[model samples]
Target: MTTPAPLRFRRNDWLELGLAALAEQGPAGLTIEALCRRAGKTKGSFYAHFPAIEAYLSALAGHWRETFTLRLMQEADRGEAPRDRLLALDRMALALDGRIEQGMRRLAQLDAGVAATCAAVDRERIAYLEKLHGESRCFAPAEARALARIEYAAFIGFQQLDLGLSPQELHDCYGTFMRLVYPPSFRSGPRV
Candidate 1:
């Protein structure tokens, strides 16, 4: 048999591989050699995409923000009603890989750049949630802000707990949370 051709990786490829590595092995898995080995690529391929490990880490943060937060928000915005938007957002958010989120949180504890990125993403999520809750007319502005934080806390906490929950289990757990916190009038939807 002929020898296999060399692997060629693009920037996004490297970022995706790095994210997977982070999820699988935590921050320790992010070393240049580890990433290269996981991707079956060479140092040259990685260096061509990123000048250094710091740059790679920074890009990985950006990738996470784009893929997990901003994009989900955009998709959720498609729903006309605020309640529908909130449900859509919840569905997508719950379906995300919690391991990656836990990995990102761990990385944030180690890297200031990643910490700042995580902070920004948290703010963005809370702000969107606050807006949705307020617009749903289910709560007053002050209540909406407080509820948003509570909901966000639940999301982060679930990731940390790692209860071996499937997406459906996680969704059901959030539904239970919503049923407990939201008024009965707002609990008629399939989400609850």
Candidate 2:
């Protein structure tokens, strides 16, 4: 039988593959050969999109930056009430790709470019979180700022923790963590 036409992998196709590789194998392991193998394509296809590995990595980080930060900001902007926004933020935070986040943090530790990108993303997340904290109506400005820092750290730490939980179980865990960190006034909602 005649061979089928080669699959057409576009720029986004490469970026998505690269993002997966970033999560699974860190930046140092993001070789063009590995990407090509994972994508089931030849080097030609990869070169068609990115001139080099650095460009591909940059595009992958940019894609994550755009989507990840936007999800937080968009979620934080929802729900007029501070508690509602907090809930939205919590849900978004829990739903994030933990593997990619961990991989990014690991890469950020060694690479200045990745470090800067991670810093910017952290700032964005903290800024949105601070706004929600300000509206929380329980803490003064300095207290809110301090609480937000701790809250964001807890968010990151929880993601790294291997609870081996199913979705509902993790949701329960989030609820428990929220109660520990937030005052009773802000702890309205399911106790589970």
Per-residue lDDT of 71 in model 2: 63
lDDT on C-alpha atoms for all candidate structures: 0.88, 0.76
The number of clashing residue pairs in model 1 is 0
- Give the winner by TM-score: 1
* Runs of candidate 2 exceeding 4 Å displacement: 1-6, 163-170, 181-183, 189-192
Model 1 Cα lDDT, one tens digit per residue, 1-192: 111324667899889887888878899989999888877778998999899999999999999999999999999999988878988998899878888999999999999999999999999999999999998798899999999999999899988995888888888888888778778887776652
**Per-prediction TM-score:** 0.92, 0.83
Model 2 per-residue lDDT tens digits across residues 1-192: 111324788898887776677777776557888777787888998898898877776777777887778767786686788878778777776677788888878877876777788888988878777878888777788887887888788778766788687656767776776687778878867442
Prediction 2 global C-alpha lDDT: 0.76
lDDT for model 1, please.
Answer: 0.88
